[model samples]
Target: MKEEEILPKLLSCFKETVEINQLIQKEINGKDIFDSYYESDLYKERIYKIQDLDTSIGILIGRLYKTSINLNYYYFDCPSQVYLNHIEEREKIYFDENIEADEKDFLLNEIQYFNNPEVNRSLDFGNFDCYSYGKYIDYEERFKITIRRKLEYLSQRLEKYNLTVDIQEETNIIDDNGNMIGYGTEAIVRTKIDKEIEPIETKSKNQLTANQIILLLQEIGFFIHPKIEDASKVKQAELISLITGLHQKNIKTNIQKLDKSVSENGANYQRDIDKINKILDDLV
Candidate 1:
């Protein structure tokens, strides 16, 4: 059953249990104070009613416990920590000296919603993402694809300007002892910016950043991923880093970690990774 349904039934059952218990106690007290005077037909009926109520209460209590366990499971399964962290980060944005009282009060109430499961559940409009708001928690696969496609789009753009792209990949054969023996014959795609394109046009009033250039290039008969475009600045940078081959540092300001690292350590090709890391880090 739904949590909303369970809660009200549990409350009604509890209230009835309290009322029935009071009646039973009152009858016992009257019988002790007035001897057999309390043994009327009405008194017998009340006693039977108490027994029936006790049985009903036992059943209700069992259902309550089961329903409670179900609710607890739902609560624990939710991405509460993710939402809490988001709220905490948002609230900390107001820690600066020039914060307004109204803004502070609004944030205070927003944070309280995370503490109340009923409020949070009430706001769950089918999309039960761990975070209460429209915050996304999983975009790793989307990021990877976005970066790869963007690089391909950039490569095509370079070709339009009479530039060539070279991409190469080689796999080293590892023997039983895990020592690199020989290189595979498979051809790897390579990328190289032409020296001729070093001074690309940048004087336009709406000149694109290096990353935006990559994104804009995809607009030529190619569509950019909406998620990537709609993503936060930090996410965009991380996606760019993944595609261009760079180590993505966690977003320190927002306290969100990009747990996946696309960097190659102790690899022969460090130049591209290093160059991309520098370019993206500057923007990040």
Candidate 2:
């Protein structure tokens, strides 16, 4: 229940996670006849069990932290899914003699573009074949790296509070063209830190929950139609609108519009949160 006590539990949970990851890694490597055998019914069952256990542990750890998750990014734009769906449709169109020559050429070019690795990294040249044992291992390895990086970041961040926590949430950073470039991860920390003194004007201000921010952005008005598909941009727009009261077609534009007053208020609010967290850390 206390702040100091939280770290030990987190460390213990992480130890379990590490063990599970190691076990999975070993299975993925396979030995003798077992090499590349993740396709076996037994292996599939074991993999699912490990995944379920990991989810359960993560949930338990979140409860201990008392912090809720905010969706910062979407790592799963799933371009592979899009490419596959389009392939099926394109095939049907290609077979249609009634289709125009120019339209058919356009479809062929689009498919070729999706197939090009230099054009899109997420393209699945294997079609759905990547769902098999050998390919799944590759997928698992990438996922493992992502999880480890997140844990490392959180452990370092919580070290200041003498607590360690691990929670995985994706925040997809996109470029001006709405292409995903990178992402961020976040976790929650709940401590029994005593409430700090409230400044007169800012004291009554409430932080908006993730859902509230979404609704607020929709109410502010959309340029064309709502772009809810890219959550990171939506979040950026929400902050920019709140601070500058101006709307932009894209995230970068909105961020660039932040003025001195908005910047100072954000800094002050963060300082307050940090002060409160440090106080809570000391108390535990």
Candidate 3:
């Protein structure tokens, strides 16, 4: 598309994304849940409880990445299937189906924490639910938000070219002017603004397909090793070995050091794919 058309649409999309960013920022400003009458042993108990839950979530395979999830976060870290099973056993319903708003808010709070732009402390909670809000900027949530904003911008911009362009492949509807309309209670109310527009077959350079991303991660040398039952169990020695290899090659990957915090959330979060991939790779 021409710059004249693309820029304005891009600006519009970015404008909308500001709302999302603000929401995220607001969420991060909230306090940690473990701030209650916290004690050391109690904290350890909570960690193990979550890890046991993670063990189960970690067993299931991920549809998108074909790996175990990190059920500790009880949000994105859990495996889909195992977590689904865990949820079924605990809540008797899926998260999206019957979860209470308060409970969901609580869970999403943790998700938001783990997904915080600054998630460095998340994996290293050290007997506490460690978290950071916006400084890390290296976590998956930031990556997703960044990519989505860009897509929205490009999609809006492309319409100026009189082209039917959408950044998201799953996008089903678009107005004639090429702006995006959100979902509704029933059939989404939308009107086409263009009389006729040609669709673009080209993919965006920055956007990575699910499979492409998986392949790229593999190329970065994040493969499964079955020698250890749990990644978390890796003592200083294993940590040194695994991290050394990755650091030498300049790549980042999580080492679970398996510990069963199965009573935790991700087991039933219904798609903690990342954790599942990490765990199941060895089991399989």
Candidate 4:
């Protein structure tokens, strides 16, 4: 659903969860904390209680709905209406955490990039193409003859299937040829319409940074595939070098020793996976 529709549902769920938390807190404390103490020792101890209550409310609020994560489109609905149509093979997943507020908004923006319905539909629309062709009968009339043969075949198919068929061919006064939607305006005309695609919003700088990290991770994954022996050695040496703050030459020296221990170390690429991850985390 659109944001206009989603806001109310989210608000309602938040309100309901808040109410439930209020009731639970009231039942446990027999009174509210704000009325008794915000300026005293009681307040310090009560801070923990307030935090507990807030966490409870957040969890309850989250449990009331489902979150759908899509690669190309994001969709969200309550459990009752979670099914959707026309999504590509990328599966929808969910995160159950009550993430921090800033992180949540940032993630929502990223999700909107893929799941925005207008954007998704526009992507599908943009790939539509149309073509038009024509044939002139100046030489041996092979083009015209092929067109007639196809038409005759189509007519026979219509008769065999007992279906109505419309066969219309016009003679061109300029070219003096008989054809269907063939040749130039002097003989025939054919037209096709292409579906236009709308442009998507440019990605945020933060998102671009994260994508870069993911690409690096993918490259590292290739270096440590399970099929290779001592694959774990290179990964381990990289991890050790990360903690030890070793120079590139030093890290390579360590990795070479590990490679010497294992037979399948052909051209293993060097990668700084930690730095890439740090960059991604900073953006998030």
Candidate 2 local lDDT, residue 190: 22
Order of models, best lDDT first: 2, 1, 4, 3
Residue 141 of model 4, lDDT score: 41
Candidate 1 RMSD to the correct structure: 24.7
| Residue 173 displacement (Å), model 2 | 12
Judge candidate 2 against the unseen true structure and give its global Cα lDDT, from 0 to 1: 0.40
Per-model TM-score, in order, reads 0.22, 0.26, 0.19, 0.20
Note the Cα lDDT for every prediction shown. 0.39, 0.40, 0.33, 0.33
Q: Can you write out model 3's per-residue Cα lDDT over 120-157, one digit (the tens) per residue? A: 22222244433322221222443344334433433343
Query: Sorted on TM-score, highest at the top, how do the candidates line up?
Result: 2, 1, 4, 3
CA deviation > 4 Å runs, candidate 3 = 1-37, 61-195, 204-284
Better of 1 and 2 by TM-score: 2
Query: Which of 2 and 4 is the better model by TM-score?
Result: 2
Q: lDDT tens digits, residues 13-66, model 1? A: 445655766876776774566667367776677667766655654454444334
- What's every prediction's RMSD, in angstroms? 24.7, 22.1, 22.5, 27.8
In candidate 1, the residue pairs with backbone N, CA or C atoms under 3 Å apart (3 or more residues apart, or in different chains) clash, namely 166-190, 166-191, 167-189, 167-190, 167-191, 168-189, 168-190
Best by TM-score: 2
Candidate 2: which stretches are off by over 4 Å? 1-13, 30-36, 59-284
Question: Candidate 2 vs candidate 3: which has greater TM-score?
Answer: 2
